[model samples]
Target chain A: MMQKSTIRVLLAGAAIATVLAGCGARDKAPAAQPQVAPSVAHSSGNAGSSAEPQAPQSKPQAPQPKTASVHTYFGDENGTGLVVKQTTITYASDSDKYGAALKALQHPGDSKAVSLFDGFTFKSVKLESGKLYLDLKLDDQARTGSEAEELTLQALQKTLFQFPEVAEIYVTVDGAKVDSLMGHMDLPYPIKRSQ
Target chain B: MKRLWVGAGLLLGMLALPQVAMAAGGATTQLFLNGKPLAAEVPPRIISGNTLVPVRIIAENLGAKVGWDDRTKQVTVTSGATKLVLTIDKPEVAVGDKTEQLEVAPTIVEGNTMLPVRFVAEKLGLKVTWDELTRSVFLYKKSSGTAAADSGANGGTSGAGGSAAAGAGAAGSTGANAGAGTAGGTAAGGASAGVAHAAEPDPDSKPGIVQAIDFTGDRLTIKTNGVTTKPNLFHLSGPERLVLDVPYAVLDEALKAKLNGTVGEIAVQHPLAQKIRFSNYSSDPPTARIIIDLKGRAELVPVEAKQLQPGQFAYDLKLAKYLVVIDAGHGGKDSGAISVTGKMEKTFNLAMATKVSELLRKEPLIEVQMTRSDDTFVELDDRVAFANTRNADLFLSIHGNKYTASSTGTETYYYRDESLDFAKTIHKHLVPATGFADRGVRQEPFRVVKGTTMPGILVEVGYLSNKNDEKKMFDEAFQNQVAASLVAGIKDYLNIQ
Candidate 1:
């Protein structure tokens, strides 16, 4: 068990390193969102550091923590299937990272993609015993068809399930459990990872 | 003003495409008027976030006069002393001398002048309550002071005797008649249907208000007041009868009136059942009983019981033929996984599922159903529920996989233990036809496989991400070979010649 866990940790580190490298090589990102994929530039404290000196200087001379790029799912151009995109997120802790991932759902990587999460305002995100509870305030009149409602939940599920710690997810609107997102398709409370 | 004029044309376009039309309307929203399902050609639909219904149906049922003016493109509804005028594609409705703004304009769908029912019903002194669990809309007349008090008296009596009825135990029928402590609670049954339109917070009041027992096609749907309760099901062998006993429930007045005689027989037409019988069962603990008398040694198999809404439940019973649900995963807006060649996994899945469905249809003993026949976005939950509600014997979800380019093979997945054998049999015939590496039958918690109760399998024909696999997947001849192999596997699993 010890060896298996050690190997798993090594594989995870390698995966993160690969993602960090990819973030560094992606120079064709939109100019307005230049802060996108700043993992390598920020962590190494070199290369792009000359452009933004204060960013590196703000922290002590100690090795700066790297920004991690996570895979975020969003609605495609037609608002049909979910398209995976890499989003760079900075976090002070694990809980902060979970919140950032949820917040990322609201902003799609591309203009053509849609975000079903716009109607929800994230109230609180709590993780206990591998179960993640997300409390959100949903707009009273935000109703959609069956397909849209299902797709929205699927996107939310796919995005959050990427975190290894989140074994299950439960969503509450206005701090109350709702039967469905828009009176279409029943939502399983504490949606299992398998779901 | 110009955009409003396009409503008719837009509606026509939507109707032309059956899938689009289904999506535009909240698929499961049922409308009830005076305690019965409103027999409307078009179901209630949400347009621009507002629930709209045919004004004619509710108006006529409420004993109101409805008039349409062709020249002005306006509808005039006069219910008692209140008069309301609504113009086509207009956002404002004239209620008496006052004008009220509508968030969504009145649109003509299928020649029916659809209006936001809540606004129109309220204006006509009608009460509109929506049940989100069942997506049901209840339209009824407003209650008077005397009516409320009368219903309250019934509730008080029922509440008092609730404990005595509970003590009556499983054989509630015998103990209930003797303990008539409910004091002719039949009045509550008759009046409460009209009085209690929504689930009130009062615990003493009836929670399980059995709204209507609907028998349509091959299904029996029990509409309730959004209270969840499990019904005890048992079979009697003398004449082959199935009994369903629902606890903590009382039949609504409209439904109780349909009971016909002391036995509460409900006349129904079905291949399996000779007739259906219903009764209040008990008043204090509140229970309802439905008995289905089978015909000619017809085996009444309790296939599935689904909660259609929080308060609504449907039971499907099957006899003779085996039902197989063919699901084509992801369509229309949901392209699923995009292939290396830019082809969609949705198209491949639909094509494969359709081919297998056609083969299954030819079999005499096998009845085939497809979750979707064409390009349409069906929710994952909807697909599972659709199969479950129909009580299908087998479920097959077709899809193409997507991963790294190196991952190229055909694989089959099953979540439930019962489905493992089915998946293995299907994989045996399927993997060889793909002419790819055999990944073997594996256990995976895919939503489609996990959600379905029946022995179900999701077959990943080949990886869409791989260039070689993607090329082969697009080949029509290869698809035909896979489809034929799949059908053979199904026949093998079912032990059919």
Candidate 2:
């Protein structure tokens, strides 16, 4: 019985080594990051930031999830400019911080600022190779004039650019690229931090 | 057992093929007018490669009165001075005093008088388009003047210009029936020619009809069948004459014949005018020109021109002043935005605009005209067009702002460089009197401000979402103060002491 148990342990060790070897080349590339599926079940306490390497925990614990303090921009009272507000968002085990920060934008808090996402909801928030892709579901009444569109887009860009991991932002509606967000201004395919 | 079942299914499928083919061959045709589905008591259908629709349905929708004579088996359609008579089973149609041939004539089907769709629609001065893919026929009023058969098209009223052109063109062809009455009549007939010709170019748009121009005493009344836009009046020094150009309007047959002689002079003797002459000014846009030879050194006063009714406008030569158009933003189906107190923004805008208009009306030499006096929706394009066409010196669009609940301020926007001073002058008086935060005068390409030729500005009185601002904007005393300040600002800008 002892000999049979030793053979099973060896077989398990070899399977892990083979799986690690298959992604060995990709692990060394500087530009390539772990492609996290949005449906992956993450652990609490320490999933680590996207900028750092994730360490596997030997013993999992039911500890408190980490929270991040993010800076979000909202429309000013007159809706002609953007105003910044600091927000602290709590994340679940499987939730992404990028998504949590975006969700906080819908609520303007006590700042008396107008929300740009009033008639919109987030469909997906994804980060790949320092590029953040955001898909939004628009309501039928989601219409803005030219002035409102300019100020709202500025608010969104200012909010997302605060994250160090996000180098560029790409916005789509219901998973498809459209000509304009509110039929007023053209949306660049990948909105960079400069804009 | 499985093989037996498969054989039975195959036999059943073979029997259904003929029924599907028959359905495709006899497709039920649909009819649409101005992009709305028009349900007919008898659905339109294709017969002998021509589409036929109920006569009363198409005629009455085009704003024509239809009468059926059982004795003569005839259908008569009358619009304004124009009349069309169609006999049952006769391929010839009588329009006014002229006769035109049709491929298919009026016929009685199921006790309803049916006529060729395109022929009757064109005779009634409506644009007709046929779509074979959906087996639909679309008819539009000429005033809408859009090529696309969609409801989003601009809804301009069908002015008397088109029917006047049709009537005049029909009468003009009576003496010379051998030749087609210009391209207007041929274009209407050509658009009606066959089936599956959806790709054909649209017929020429008929211009607004100018029925009569009567000048008596100091009042000159221009009568049209439909609402004619404001006329453009200018004075010429060389001939010492005053020229009045009516846009999108054409002279009727009787009037055209009356002014057929050399120089087309109408004998008139009045203190304001010595002689009156009329002519068809521009054919492409169908503008009618009426020139008045002024006596002495009297200048033609560019004032007292008002739209008396839907299709009538009168000019009083005794008055001269500046016209200011006040526009209230958003109403009716479009409530604009709901306020923090659940009040509609359109209501506040109308109240403020009306107050300002009332104050401006009391001012000497300052004429006030409002885009809307009550709760009704007007298109953005139409508002701009109204100001430009009326030759107004200034245009002001009043609106209530909406943002976050904390938003409270007053701001004004101007698009053109020339309107910056107007914006600044208005805001200077508005902000101090309202006692709200002065958001400053800014530049934005709002539709009303950008499209108007005259100096125009759009002012946001206060944020409707803010509780304090909403309460103040709805107050009668506050409205009176704001209205007085606005009039003072206008007087300052126009240099009216």
Candidate 3:
């Protein structure tokens, strides 16, 4: 599991990897310490420490995402509608994050979390013609309205765009291009990652 | 003074002809281009105030190959520069980079595909004219818009200023929050308020028509028909051309005569202020785009002044300056997040944004502008527009986080991959100063970052939902400290002293 509790420490080390390189690089900085700051996360953690960042205990291995974490921007009923929450979703293989992310979207674990794909059924997600075709089945085609449908599409589009391998998103209801979700909001316009 | 007055009179004479030529009374319209008659098989007719013609008739002659998918009910028209996609009975048409709503959908006529003539022509770069008296519709591509259209090919509303379109919006704060304009934004839901989706159809919708265009003293003001419109204005370098897009506006053939759409080449000489070009970027909620190519001694000034009218805007060109626009997250009816202390997160955001701007201004040659200098509500789209039109080098949006009083930390977000380094560079310095848990720099599709063409970041400084975090954040002195820290971080990221 790629826990923020762990990766943060290593990320902090990478941020200060210059510190461990023995001050030989920059001639005029503070004398370099060859240690990694595993406790760097805590420096900001309610510690209220005003001191400069210290060096971390040395580690030989390179910093990389050995354990993957899924960052989900779930709609928060309390605050700004959406608050990002992380899940320790590491795959057995490196290529498994896509499946895991979809699973995470199905259930991201929040009491106030609103379902973006509620009326729509998840039929399948396929890569066709350089675009990701997300085929869905509608539960109630007649009554979808402005508020819920737009939010759902926003959630779905944002979530799918996270995976760069999936170039664009084309949503279909019961294997057909939809005009709108409930009545007003339109759908399946080949959603691309916003530049 | 003499040149400015001369250009203004010429602009009046140039633009006045189109409005006079398009006086409405047409049942059936004939096609004409550059004084030449255009013959069509099906003939063009008006439906519900919009003109519709055979897709093949207009599509084929405009140097386009038309294709149809009968099973899918889709019509795809491919041209050299633009691809037009429309579905039968569907009110939406996909133009390049935007999905525009058609006032009337396409239908099959006899054996041919029929679509909105104004929409198809405007989207395909063909200018349209409807003479009510003659009942004639003219369609043709100008041989002169090369310099203007060529400028359109190079992307971005900033870096080099370009076109902009403004659609009048309803007074729905949270209602239009549902107006999802977040192009590739990762921020999930509309937590803030007063974000009205301008393009949504309503009876209150105003027509976007260009009234008058005046080029005086290096500034160009493209006035609209009735009410004023917020125009997207830009100017390109290397020949210095001004481009303006009036959203929800339409054009008649008279305006086409003024343009020189010889794609990709700038005209250096013309009898009327270098060369002039115009294109209808969109028709559903129609947008009228005008580009003026400037010649020797022509330079655009950075200041943009909105006239006394509701939508009259005048701007000169300003290029290659390192200007930073700091946006305070939410305001007024857009309460943003309600803190645990019952304080609005918008309060904190504005405070932080103000401080950052104040501190950054202290730096030499660094320009700083706040999206909202006070507590006035600025919509999501407008916030990006302010940064873009201002030609900011970097943009920073400030907001406080909200959750179940437990999720606490400082997290910085970016939309594009290029902004990651900018986000990280700021987070590296900003997070440590907050004395909050570092959530790390992450990439999320956010409007402030995604909607902008420059390096932009949205900083969630701390969680107001958390009591401890709120305590530190609520401190006015603490906000000033965070603001100063943010400024230092920006300086670090920008590599300025």
Best-matching candidate per DockQ: 2
Which digits, one per residue and each the tens of the lDDT, describe model 2 over residues A30-127?
Answer: 12112311111222233233223345446555444454444566777668877665554556642377787777777775445667777778889988
lDDT of 3: 0.56
Q: Tens-digit lDDT track for model 2 on B37-148?
A: 3445455768887789876565546567889776587888888677989899898889999999888878855435788888877776665766654566766554323323
Candidate 1 ranges with C-alpha deviation above 4 Å: A1-195, B1-149, B152-319
Cα deviation at B46, candidate 2, in Å, is 42
State each model's CA lDDT, in order. 0.64, 0.64, 0.56
Which regions of candidate 2 are displaced past 4 Å? A1-72, A76-80, A84-104, A107-114, A118-150, A153-195, B1-241, B244-316, B361-369, B376-379, B389-391, B404-406
TM-score of predicted chain A against the true chain A, for each candidate = 0.68, 0.65, 0.55
Candidate 3 structure quality by residue, lDDT tens digits, B125-226: 655656555555655353333425544543321321111111112111111222212121111111111111122122135655665666665555565655
TM-score of 3: 0.36
Chain A of candidate 1 gets a TM-score of 0.68
Q: Model 3 clash tally?
A: 37
lDDT of 1 by residue, B1-497 (tens): 00001111211221222211222243445555433334343456777667888765656555578898855878888987889899888998899999989998888653356878888877776656665544556665534432335433533334334344343343344323322122111110011122222212223445477787777777877777766355555444445666555655777888778754434666788877887877776443345767678774333333344536566667676665678999987776567666777777789889999999988888877889999999998867668767765657899988887644566788787889999999999999998899999877867556678778789988889878789998998898999999989988989998878
Per-residue error for B190 in candidate 3, Å, reads: 32
